[model samples]
Target: MRTGFFTHADCSRHEMGGWHPECPERLQAIQDQLIASRIDPFLQHREAPPASLEDIGRVHTQSAIARIRDHIPSPSEHYYSLDGDTFLNPFSWDAALHAAGAAIAATDAVVKGELANAFCAVRPPGHHATPTESMGFCLFNNVAIAARRALDVHGLERVAIVDFDVHHGNGTEAAFVGEDRVLMVSFFQHPFYPYSGTSDIGAHAVNVSVPAYSGGDQVRQLVTQNWLPALHAHRPQMIFVSAGFDAHREDDMGQLGLVEADYAWLTQQIMTIADQYAQGRIVSSLEGGYNLSALGRSVAAHLKVLAGLD
Candidate 1:
């Protein structure tokens, strides 16, 4: 089966500002690179549907949902800042909904045998947004909502989330801290933004934090030593990836020195786990990557692994 490619045009309209690093151009970069790398034609592309409030409410609080809805401004109005970095424009709510919806749609598609695996290319990158709050350029926790759907709607008992973002996925960790059914493994640059996941995370969370300026060797070593052992023991039923490429050496967003090859290698490792325990079912969503060139190259490498072309 072809891998699924999910995205929406509304994702391009949810910009925080002209100078923001999390710009809409990030999606365009990925698309352009996919075409340039000759990988676009090998996948099943789908336009994302907007997520219902009921779907979002499964992972977020009622008050948080109300705040995101209430903060939507008129088309002629200026953007409303939810925090120092996060903001809501007229189209932000729609974009956020579709970004999350893309994740849910991908999950449904993979779980129902319509596809082998899927990648969500939507924006307004989520991972920092918690259940009751939105921050760090995230208004909704997209991957968390999808994992919940896999568990609640698709009857999945053991779901796993692996995040490789440059920053800690504190919000995603918060959503499933003590849930025995879910196992989360991740590596992020330490002593950085959010300043979390350093220690004291619950048993379900395997947060391997590396010092600033660490490179791909550290990532490989951690996966071999820490993440692999945990994943093998857990034997997850489905695997979800919070795929973030900001750790790329070219991206100034974080100090981690990961390159495109690192992402491809890591994805191959995850694929081995999927083949072993999950019937090759995987869902991945874009989270953070600032440098356009690096983001595009890294995503293409990751997609090549997902599509079995590498």
Candidate 2:
């Protein structure tokens, strides 16, 4: 089985604005680097299907879904602001659906053994959208939805969510804080945007709050000393990753110092855990990588490891 690569054209059409860092060009950059790195052909590509309201409602509130569905702007209108940073254009709704659908589809494919694992390269990057609200450029919580799907639909007893974004995945934590069936392990830069992972996270979560300018060595240590022990103890039946590359030194979105090699190492470590307990089933979704060049290179490195090309 190969690594499935899931995406959708609607994702590119969901732009916030010309000045936004989370532009359509982010997907193009990943594609460009995958082709340039010659890793594109190794991936089994799949166009994402739009997620149903039922699928979305598993992780989000009905009111939140209604709000997003009702607020989509007409083509004549450029955007509708959900918050200061998140906005909706005419295509934003479909894009958000497909972005989330990519994660769900990838989860299904991996769970069914159609693929060894999968990477969802779609966006309006999630991880910031909570159950009752959409914020930080996210319309839906993609990874959270995927994790829920793995448990509720597939009957998985144990699952893990790993987030290495620069900012805390406050939304994801909120979704599965005390759920014994889920174990969420993550390391995020502290005192950052959507800042809420530092205190009183439940027993089901192991959240490491690191300082800005922290390097790969620190992350590796944290993963080994913190994430790995908890992951092994949990023995997750499947693993879902909220893969974010903005921690790269070149990405101005945050001040962490991770590089491409660090990303490859991180994927390898996660793969090790998945192999041991999850039968190598992993579903990863894109989140928060801004620097075009760095994002491209970092995603390639991460995918190379997932595809066993590294």
lDDT digits (tens) for residues 1-310 of candidate 2: 9999999999999999999999999999999999999999999999999998888999999999988899999999889999999999999999999999999999999999999999999989989999999999899999999999989999999999999999899899888877999998889998888878888766788989999999999999998999999999999999999999999999999999999999999999999999999999999999999999999999999999999998
Clashing pairs in 1: none
Q: How far is each candidate from the true structure, as Cα RMSD in Å?
A: 0.7, 0.6
RMSD of 2: 0.6
lDDT scores of the candidates, listed in order:
0.94, 0.94
**TM-scores for all candidates?**
0.99, 0.99
- Model 2: per-residue Cα lDDT at residue 216: 97
User: Clash totals for all models, in order?
Assistant: 0, 0
The prediction achieving the highest lDDT against the true structure is 2
Q: Ten-residue segment with the worst summed lDDT in candidate 1?
A: 198-207
Q: Candidate 1 lDDT, tens digit per residue, 46-83?
A: 99999888888888999998898998988888698889
